[model samples]
Target: MFTNIRKFSAVVVTSGAALALLSACGGTDSASMGGHDMSTMSSSAPAATAASAQPSATFNDADVMFAQMMIPHHQQAVEMAELADTRASDKEIKDLAAKIKAAQDPEIQTMQGWLTAWGKPMPSGGTDHGMGHDMLGMMSEEDMKKLADAKGAAFDKQFAQLMIAHHNGAIEMARTEQSQGSNPEAKDLAKTIEAAQQAEVEQMRKILKRL
Candidate 1:
């Protein structure tokens, strides 16, 4: 009977040890699975953040065309404004030209930036891409030459007249942009251009009367 009890006790102890070992293995497996889950969550978070951080390329074709066409348009205006510094006799004309140059130079750079961001081509070398005189208010090469040759009162009158026409053309373009453009920034700029150029046009008309 004593020998039977010793054998039974050994069997019970061995079974208990096996159960303990199994419990430890189960705990290790649960910890490993939890670690894997945590790692997956951490990795996915950065990927989500990266996706959200990327710039929204929400621009449409109208935005592209507006930027492309306006760059050259602004460039020509700046050129005309530059001529006023040397050729214009009226103090008002000179001041107006300076203002035009200052406003348009920055605008040209801004439009260029938009084109670059959109992966669209810029107007080459400040030249309209065959758009030429067909573009509203664009002076022909001949017109530009005449302005370049004139001085004093002739320069001031011609400059004011040409600039007035140019501003009208710009206002028309801005109106089109406001109607058609999808990008918020581009539409906002179009509105600004329309209002500002309209005011300038009125001012120029007043100046024309004086001249």
Candidate 2:
């Protein structure tokens, strides 16, 4: 009887120890799960800064002035080119006007966009370039009216002369841009304008001689 009671006591002790070990294991698992939760908790993400967003092109005051002045200047050239129908009789003169319009119209838009992107004001429209001004070779109201009233050989001759002068003014402005402007794109455009207008000036001079 004593032997059976000793075996029963031993079995009870072993079961109690096993139960304690199971409870400890469960506690350890709960603590480990809580640590995982803590690891996941963090502050919200940061807001996007202006620098992180898209950047604007770099430019300077000279570039701004170039675009501002050139916009209106190109507009006038396009307008003069459009007057070829009533004011041009030479087939070459008419073709040249059309070409000028085609080139300058888009160039005007591009300059306007540059001003807007740079957060600058657009220039007011006018053709009253005074004597000794940088905006030389711009036609006066009287000059345009005279060309509009002429026809045949007179129209052809007047158009050639005025357009030649107009191109020279553009070349001067472009040279200023090329020399002092800060924007790479604007400078490149200025260079292109100088070359193309110089060529056109020569062509117009030749046309004038023929007329």
Candidate 3:
């Protein structure tokens, strides 16, 4: 009878261990299911983000050229605007100069950021990235020098004339970007430039008539 009791105890212990092992395996399987679901969600999120980012990330040669060419164009305009602080005779001209400087300065930084992102070089030196005379409405060295020499009323008139041409050139370049560039942000910037500069050109023309 004691031998039978010992055998029964051994059987009970074995059955209990088997139940515990089974329970552990079930818990592990449940945890694995939850983990797989989370992993799937995490993986899909990046794919969605990449898809959304694709348009802005993609750019073409025109977009590159637009930014490259415009940075110097804007720099020159800002220089011209700076001259108005001391050189311009009219309050209108001074106000306009301030406006131009404010608008174009941020634009310059923004384009620089783009070039950096694209691994493209900034236009070297004071010139328009070798576009030179071919770059429409860019002031000649002589033209800038002459403007610098002038003071008061003469400076205001010259500033208006030169800036009208400058604005026209920027508008053309912006239109080109709109038509040919692939990047959404660049094209949008181009459009903003075109609209804003066109309005400024009109305002300058009116100012010219008054002068």
Candidate whose TM-score is highest: 3
Give all TM-scores, in the order shown. Answer: 0.71, 0.70, 0.72
Looking at candidate 2, what is the lDDT of residue 84?
Answer: 88
TM-score quality measure for candidate 2: 0.70
**Candidate 1: worst-modelled 10 consecutive residues by lDDT:** 36-45
Number of the top lDDT candidate: 3
- Give the CA lDDT, 0 to 100, for residue 65 in model 2: 58
For 97-117, candidate 1 gives per-residue lDDT tens digits of 888787777676666777777
- Scored by Cα lDDT, where does model 1 land? 0.61
Candidate 2: residue 138 lDDT (0-100)? 60
* Clash list (residue pairs), candidate 3: none
Candidate 3 runs further than 4 Å off: 1-55, 128-131
- Give the per-residue lDDT digits (tens) of candidate 2, residues 69-98: 665556667767778876677999988888
Kindly provide the TM-score of model 1 when superposed on the true structure, using C-alpha atoms. Answer: 0.71
Considering TM-score, where higher is better, how would the candidates rank from best to worst? Answer: 3, 1, 2
Choose 1 or 2, whichever is better by TM-score.
1
